[model samples]
Target: MLRLAPWKVASILAVTFLAVLLLVPSFLGTATVDRLEKLLPSFLPVRPIVLGLDLQGGASLLWEVDSAALTHAQVETLRDDVRGKLREGRISLSGGIAVLPRGVQVRIADAAERAKALPLLRALDQPISNAIIGTAGHMLDITDVGDGSVQLLLTDAAINDKIRRAVTQSIEVLNRRLNESGTKEVNIQQQGVDRILVEVPGLQDTTEVKKLVGATANLEFRLVADPGDPPNEVDNLPQQQGGQIPVQKRVMVAGEDLTNAQTGFDQNSQPDVNFTFNLRGGQRFGQVTSENVQRRFAIVLDGKVISAPVIQTPITGGRGQITGNFTVQEADNLSVLLRAGALPAKLTVVEERTVGPGLGQDSIDAGKRAAIVGGVLVVCYMLATYGIFGVFADVALAVHILFIFASMALIGATLTLPGIAGVVFTIGMAVDSNVLIYERIREEAHMGRSIISALDAGFKRAFATIIDSNVTMFVAAVILYLFGSGPVRGFAVSLGLGILTSVVTAVTMTRMMIALWYRYKRPTKLPI
Candidate 1:
């Protein structure tokens, strides 16, 4: 246990040097880090510690999914599906399809058509997987009411599945939107079944963040309908400027087919959003434009008509542009929304808060004081208790703290107030393993054992106890991380890492220092 190889010493020194190097950027100013980034080699990591929202101060938003809007959209889609199925089967409806909150109903005039429609509509009952039992359930429940009426209702399982899917898609869309807008270290997570929690650090504009996340950004292309078109075939959508425009209900191309979108200047030097479509959308767009030359094409976004232009010629290049008297920022925002795609459902702001930097600085100061006081007390107690060996332990404790922060910076983990508490708590625990070893060594020396024999036996015997205690603490940290959220997770990370670092510095590092001391001085009596 007292043996120290030359390779082992080299490795420990190398790791210590790297830890110090990795930690340098955390103490430097942002401009200094930027300058060093250019001068340093590409392989060296210059990443500084990332502060959490509570530390850096930013926007905190809680959004809830619009269940009513989702239901209405789903029912509208079902009504359209029912209409198509009846038309395809050559079954005449007595009246128009009636839309419900969660389903659709249609009445067929003839009994024979009803029987044919019953089977046709039943075929639309999609098979969905039951997540709880791992069984299959139908998404739509088809029932034959009295007379020639048939009702199709959406199942509870289907509604819940759609809500869950919407929440997941919304998170992904928000992540992409925020990241593209250059918002770094943003935290977006699912709070509950229908709510999302978004915390963005260092956000300057809360309104822009809200706008970026709130807009549904649903984009569609429809043909401008003439006055003679059927009522069911046209929809009067509000225009962005004013008034209303009648557009065909059948979408010529949807935003889903968009492959890329970017902000650019038009021929008139006005800000505009340029977009490209995928293969299928390109073919459909070309076909529509070729068939409807000189007709107006209306661009609808979120149920509002943004622009309508006459199709002079077929656009076969799969590219298009939208110009709507937009400023530079508006054009950029539109491009970002288009590129991020549309949210599955509308999200309303349920709660909003902004943390200021003053509070964060106070938190930092408080944490610093707690850590410094705790570390000083530990250093004094160890030095007074174990003398020269305590100095070795103090050096190891400092290295242990360095390892914790360096590892966090290397992995880009955010540090919160709770994380600081975790680190402070770790300061007390860092000396426990050393105290145990020292006590064991003192007991062996009192038993008339030689100095080297006492040191070796003490380390070998105390190592098991050290491993057991750290293992239990590490397991608890793992559990906390798995089950907790946000700040709790931050605490778990620091505590877990501190356990590992404490083990290294307390056991290996202290033992190496003691072994080197013994080899040079050949002490007649152990220092305890």
Candidate 2:
């Protein structure tokens, strides 16, 4: 028997509040969770362990972004910009600049032209500003000194940094878009400076996701020749005569005018994507149609012509239809893509897997069965060995589990098989504290101490050992969580929380019960 002070009683109550936090949300659902989330301080760390798709029977996607292609396109665009600036300055050079494997070089007719061209090249640099321009005899060699280049020898580090930042930003944007579409448990990670990995759990329409992710949404309005029209004798139509009404030809509107799109049935009962454009797109379409009536217009997406229809008259309603040879699924996917827009860089599907809901349910069931059996066995063994004191420890162990589960529910941590195994392992370890205490009590009793004296001494002597063991395990779990990935991290989470709750229940709650019992019905003889 032992006596607990008022401070100890208050401490026990405070610890019990943690149990309430864990269990209340589980029973009440997300509304309570939302309230708790807002009420909790921002600095208070309470991030829950989210379940992976394998355990939850959801969708997993592996996408690879083509950073190399993106880099090449960006570099080419920069080169063109630089060339335009050089031409505008009217500085005649011996040869046009060429992008080399290492850097860029331009041969000038004279050393004076090279020196005059250096400032113009530097001014044209929008992305690569720290360019080292030097005259190598009659030729000027331009090398990026910044750490931003994609090539090995080019020292431009700024562009490389920008690429990494852009990739990260793109992932964040994609994550927001997917989340808006109600996808849960999404994991978006940058696989290098250029590639990205997106995992969306519970999403079945992977094709739709791919389409949405692939589009760059770069809307451009261009006038294209109708296929029905005779091929233009000239290679390219000279710039359209400004303000001149040339013979009306077929005109087409691009997808940029689209504000919203959906999959619906056409009059022929065939699946089609219906689109509505914003005011700008609608006005542009209406003008093109009004001016080019009786001519054919082509609808294009990502450079490929999808449809061509004759302009009957100006359409001002801001709405249009895309009729195509489409199946129901195809139409739905196209609509989804159009609505989501497109990614800046293309995303290639690197890996994919779908787990059925049935498998997840089975795992849940098996986990529950194993946990119950293991917990019951642990409780029974502890009670049998420690007699009356053991029963008190068993009660504390029960409280520990209650708090553990409550914490999970409160934080919305997904319970998986490995997580369940963590709980079972905790159950086996929870007895260590009680066992140490009981052994110390027995040793004191053998020394002929009174029951109350032995009980007090036992708890006091065991406290140091209990603290040392649990703290070391807790430190190990923290390290595991910091470094481990996926399921291994889950195990670490449960173990760390278990050690915390076990100490509170075993030392605080059990001590209180023992203190109250000894105060009222003080026993001289030991039960063990």
Candidate 3:
């Protein structure tokens, strides 16, 4: 029919080159692997498929904020604020307490004090919007108290809102930390306002992860007396060594002025943590050190003192180091925590499940089995029905898979069981375009056209139909991707990519093959 064109030969070569460039490096573990993995996808292939947490086996945590406790705490804070204000105003009252859901309430002790208390009470009575309020004569009552004291109630809506915000913030912080930790494919989501789900696939040290999650990273720098220093008063000094000794009090700085922190080894080959401060922090640290040379400053992290070093002189460079007993890993983790900043809300572990790598291996084995069985069956059916054309279709289909895998490896998209299934389905659906074109060719050949003429007519007539069908499916896949989450999106992605690749291979590659065959054999009669 048609001879293989130079452009088709070039295309095949290009695809082969791309497949090797994109996919072959994924099997390599050398120094160039990372560089290759990043560069291959842009010029060569589609995004890579990453394995999901379930397949890789790491840690999944479902955590719910104690909304009731949060509400109670908020109300208590409000109550304390009111109490402090009242005490400052020198007002005396019998009962004025803030409870969850309902705001604060203040009962006037005497009728004479009504005027004084009303304004204060009214000022403090910032209505918890959406809370039911009851008024009986001079008494104001807040109804809907979900938990805690009956002074003010924290509403369900308020708790839900806070939980949502907390979850969002927590995810942001966790992402930052995970990125710094060099972990990939971390999944974090809000199950509800109060609950968060975190999945870290391929993470081994759950204990370390738990530590990072639980840490608040509220760093502080305070002046502490060196245990080896002399007492403030000579008579008050303990003669013994390593006793609590009072060194001159000095304030060098705090971590609030810190802009960044990193882990490094000191000149003496000991583990140390280093931090850089902003202008403000630099200025403060400079002033404090200048004023109190030889005084010790303690670097505190999450309420524990990590190091206390004496100021020998004013450090104007705005950089300092903390030396302590630390392993290389601990130092690195500390640096990561400091750099990632702090979490908005404390993450409490409500549920946790861990999967071992062995299980993940089993899952991979099972997925491979399913894929092989399904693929072989599809190939057999396609070849049986379409004969030589079907075999051509099969070759194109295999190329599609290679391209898909190459794309996935290039992009680092995690592969899951669902994702594997998506790929398998893609293979089965990839033959549709070939089938359409082959059927059209058969019809044209039956109409008594020459082999070459019939092949051309078939491709020309079937192109539009192939486009229309694939376009419709592509649109549906887009919709599915838009509405779907997690695994559903994986399926959409695979199907969408498959459709595009199938069209190209079926119309373009199949035509090239037919041309090459016809040119070689010079077949006067139709193969159909």
Candidate 4:
């Protein structure tokens, strides 16, 4: 152990230097770090440690997917599809399609028409992709209603699948919206079957964030129905200006086809949202406008008609503007939502809490005190117990802490309150390895061995025990990270990182320090 290679020594010094460099920004002010980042090399890290919501103060919002609204949407869509299919097949229905609680039902008095309509209706049943079971089930269950009616009900598997999709899509949409709004370190994840937990760090006021996240932004364009149009084909949707407007239920274009949306001013210099569509939507839009010139089309957003304007000429440019009584902020937010696309389903806020910066600062101060006290005590104990050997361990322990923060900064890990606890706990753990080695060395020296032989034997023999203990602890950290959520996972991350750095500092670095000391001092007696 005393015969340390030149390359190993150089490598150790290089790593220590790099760790210091990596941790530099964490201790500096944000403005200073920002300036440094601009001046520094692109490959070098200048980003500061990201604090968690608990540490930096922000909002924690728990949202629940509106299963009732989701079911209503599905049933409504199914009803429309059934109507379209019956019309496409030229099959006559005995009555209007009946909307059931879980599905839609249609009666066909003619046996021949029922047989013809059955194939077209069955074609609407979508196949679900299940990872474990492969192509497992269909989205719809088609049942014969004994008499002349056929029922199309949503399957349990389909409902579950829709909920999962809604959660996933909501997360993606929220991420895009919040990130675009310059909210940093926004943590969004699925909490349960139908709930989402969103943590926005550094933003105490969550009103805007909540508004941005909750808005469904489901934009649709439909032709204003003529007075003579059938009641079943027209829907009297509420208008933003007050009262209701009769519009055709068939959507001319939807938000899904929109490629881009931006806040702009209309010809009247009023705040509006300008949108551009994709190839398919543009063609369909142009066709609708060309055929229905002089007729009005309603721009509907989240079921409310924002505007209903007469189409004086064909809109073949694939671009349009939505004029509404909107403020600049509203227009901007609307454009953002449109650009992000609509949520799969409505999300209701079930729980919400905001952490103020004052509380966060208090927690930070408490954590700092704990870490400082723990580190100082450990340092003092080591020095008083082992003399010069203790100094070496103390230096290594400092480097170990540096390595922990450096690793965290490199990986952009957020530090939380529990993470601070983990760091303090690791401070004691950092010195434990040194204590074991020092005790082992004392035993060897008492056995009549030379100082060099004792030191070498101590590290070599105690190595296996150190590895075994640290390995088990590291495994525990891994399990905690895998199973735990929020702050618990933060604790696991710090603990895991501390274990790794401690192993390096406690074992190899300390051994190297002792080896170098002995090489120069040529000590006849041990320091301990």
Candidate 5:
């Protein structure tokens, strides 16, 4: 019990030394870490903990999804489908086919033909079931408004489900956009039914994020109707020139099938974005170009025609490039948007918060001060209570802290304000573990057990209790991480990891240190 195996001694020391080394980068700034990264070999691990939005002061934005536009678009699509289905069914109507406020309105001038048209239009209604066991509904509610005019509005359940899906898709799109922009440690989560909360750490100017997230970069390839075609005749996209060009409403190839997009310099040294399509997209593009070789195809991005070049030849390879009046940054941004895909609905920034660097620094300083004070008080109390054994425990406590920071850096965790609180809270937890072992030792020694026997009995007796307490706390931390978001998740991460590392250092590392001390000194009495 007094002697540690040679392997055990080496393992404990090696871990402690490595932990100390890992913590150096966390304390140092980015320049120092960057220098070390360049100077050292790739084999050497040298990563710092990424600070979160609360600790480092970045941008926080709350965006609302535009569900109205989604409904309008869906209804427009339904109008086209109804037009096709009615025409195919040889059903004739008298008044006019127009989109009403509630839904598509088809007025039949002939009252006798109204009965025949109603049954055909009712076929447009689709089943809507949000839950597996719940009652399903139709996508459209077809009803006669008045005088043979049938109105079709989206069902309530379907609209609610669409809004939920739109919010979810907006979050996913924002995440991909931030990642593609070389931003790290971003938190994007759905706040409510229609809102998304985004927190980006270490970003000062949120203009780029806002632009990327807000830009409805919905790309589509549409056949040009004619240069003289009016806006009312077809879907018109504004050109870089003064006038607008009418284009076919039907999409030739969607941006969703674009597998990759990269910024590259054109042959004339102008910045352009090259995009590649997947198999289905490639086939569609090939067919479209082959069928309309001499016609001009418009590359429409966000309802604007960026380019309208003649299809000189069939592009069967699925590779194409967009050449426009674009700067390097604009080309790169477009590539990012194209690669990340488009959001499901437009996003409106309903709320925004930007944290300054000075504030973040102040928070970091306050956290440091609290940790120092707490650590000092803990060390002082431990030493005052059990003398040399307390000193050993204090040493273990420091090592435990080092392990926490080291693990966090290793996993690239974002250290937020709540995470710092978790670390501070862990300082006390470390002291508690030592107190448990020390008090158990004192109780054993008072029972008249020999010093060596008492020390061994103390650790063995307290093992189960220590395990139970740490396990329960660890489980709670896991629950926090699973259910929470942003700062709460950061706190959970630090706390959970701190508990595991503290337990190891508290029990195993402290035991090893005591065993080494006993082996060297041959002590007659235990310090506790």
Candidate 6:
């Protein structure tokens, strides 16, 4: 057990050097790190653990998806499609269709047309799944509801499917919007049904985040339906900064055609969102502008008119600017939204909170104090118990701290206040395996074994107990991490990483040190 090969020596040296190497830069100031980053090669490892919202200070926003609104929109679209289908089939109905519970009630003018209408309505029924995990089924059912009346209603599964899709799509869009803002360390995830959670670390102001995430960003270009129509003539007019603006129902250019959007100053140094279009959008935009020379075209976003300029010449370059009389920040936000595309459904803030830097500093300072107090006590206890061997254990404990932080940085784990507490808690536990081994060695020494035999037997006997206990705790940590969120998740991650590092330093490093000491001095008696 005291034997050490050259390769084994090299391996141990390499691990110690790496642990110290990864940890050194973390102690340096940010300016020093930046200078070194410029000077160093690309392959050198120098990353810090990302701080959580509690440590870094940021915005926490809880949003509830308007799924009921999605259902209403779906019903309206279905109603329009059904009406169009009936008109195309030349089916006559008196006073149109009445929307009823679970279906549309169409009262036919003639009883003879009822049979014809039933088949037509059935033809419009969409294919959908009936069961949650079953095969495809029909979305609607056309039933005869008394004399000359046919009802077409959507299936429960289809309505539910729409709701689920809306929630998922909203989350995805939120992620894209935040990502477009060039923001990092942002967490956006689904909370419960129809709810989303967004936490942005290092964000002091919530205004930009709220604006970017909440903006529908639904952009469309359409011609003026009636340039002379009075302002009060429109009911479905889009709401804008001034009021509702009337635009053609037919969309000339779609936002989906947009490839990029960036904030830029206009010729007059006014802030504006400059946008580019893809190949398809460019063609359509060129055709529309060329055909409608001297006619007004409106650039609309989220039902608000952005610009309504009369076409003087064809714009074939596939690029344009949206002038909304916006502030610089507003223009930047609009550009971010335009680049991120549109959310499939609307989102409303259910809860919001802002974490200031003062609170975050307090958390960080408290965490530091806890870690220092816990570490110093552990070191003192180990030193007092086993003397020289306890010194060895303390050294291993320090290495465990290095390994834990390095692992966190390497794995990109977020560190919260609870996570710091976890690390500090592990400080007390770091010397556990060594304590067991030393106790076992003491037992062997009391049994009259030689120094080498006692050391060998101690490590061999203690390893099993160490492995079993660490593995059990590791499993619990995994379960906690998988089930928990936010601070709980941070705690689980720190605890889990600390467990592995502690096991390594205790069982491996302490054993190596004792073996080296035994081989070099050739002692007859052990220190413990």
Measured by TM-score, the strongest candidate is 5
TM-scores, all models, native as reference: 0.62, 0.53, 0.57, 0.60, 0.64, 0.59
lDDT of candidates 1 onward, in order: 0.87, 0.66, 0.69, 0.87, 0.83, 0.79
- Candidate 2's error at 497, in angstroms? 1.1
Q: Over the stretch 1-528, how does candidate 4's per-residue lDDT look in tens digits?
A: 468999999999999999888888888987899799789854567877777777776788999999888888889999999999999999998989999988999999999999998999999999999888897678999988868999999998888888888899988898778655321446789998999988877656689988998788999999999999999999999999899999999998987999999988877778888999999999999999999999998999999999999999999999999999898779989998999987888888999998655355766888888889888888998889899999999999999988988888887777777888988888788799988899999999999998889999999888888889899999999998777666778889899999999999999899999999999999989989
Runs with alpha carbons beyond 4 Å of true place in candidate 5: 38-45, 61-69, 80-110, 119-165, 172-197, 205-343, 346-354, 357-368
Per candidate, the number of residue pairs that clash is 0, 17, 24, 0, 1, 1
What is the clash count of model 1? Answer: 0
Task: Give lDDT for model 4.
Answer: 0.87
Error of 1 at 301 (Å): 21
Query: Comparing candidate 1 with candidate 2, which one achieves the higher TM-score?
Result: 1
Off by over 4 Å in 1: 41-43, 61-73, 76-107, 111-165, 168-195, 202-354, 357-364
Q: Give the alpha carbon lDDT tens digit for every residue of 131-243 in model 6.
A: 56665667787788787777778887677778778878877677667743221446778787778888887655688777787777889898876767665544245555576
TM-score of model 5 relative to the true fold?
0.64
Write down the worst ten-residue block by lDDT for model 5.
176-185
- How large an RMSD does model 6 have? 11.3
**Local error of candidate 4 at 436, Å?**
1.7
lDDT of 1 by residue, 1-528 (tens): 589999999899899999999999999988899899889864468878877777787888999999778878888888988889988998898989988778998988798889889988988888777657775567898887877789999998778778888999999899778755221456789998899988876665689988898787889999999989999999999999999999999999998999999988889878899999999999998899999999999999989999999999999889999989998779989999999998888899999888665356766888878889999999999999999999999999999999999988887677777888888877777799999999999999999999999999999999999999999999999998777766788888899889999999999999999999999999988777
lDDT of 3 by residue, 1-528 (tens): 355669778978698678766776656654566576466542344333445666766787887766656566666676786687667667776665524354465554555554564455446444334224432122134332322222434444555555666677877788777644221456777786578787776655578778878877766666665466566522222212223433333334656678888888888777778989899998887777787688766666665666667878888788888776887667877877877888766778988887654346767898889999988998898889877777888888888888776666654555556667878877776787887888898899888888888889888899999899889989998887667655676667677767777787777878877777777888777655
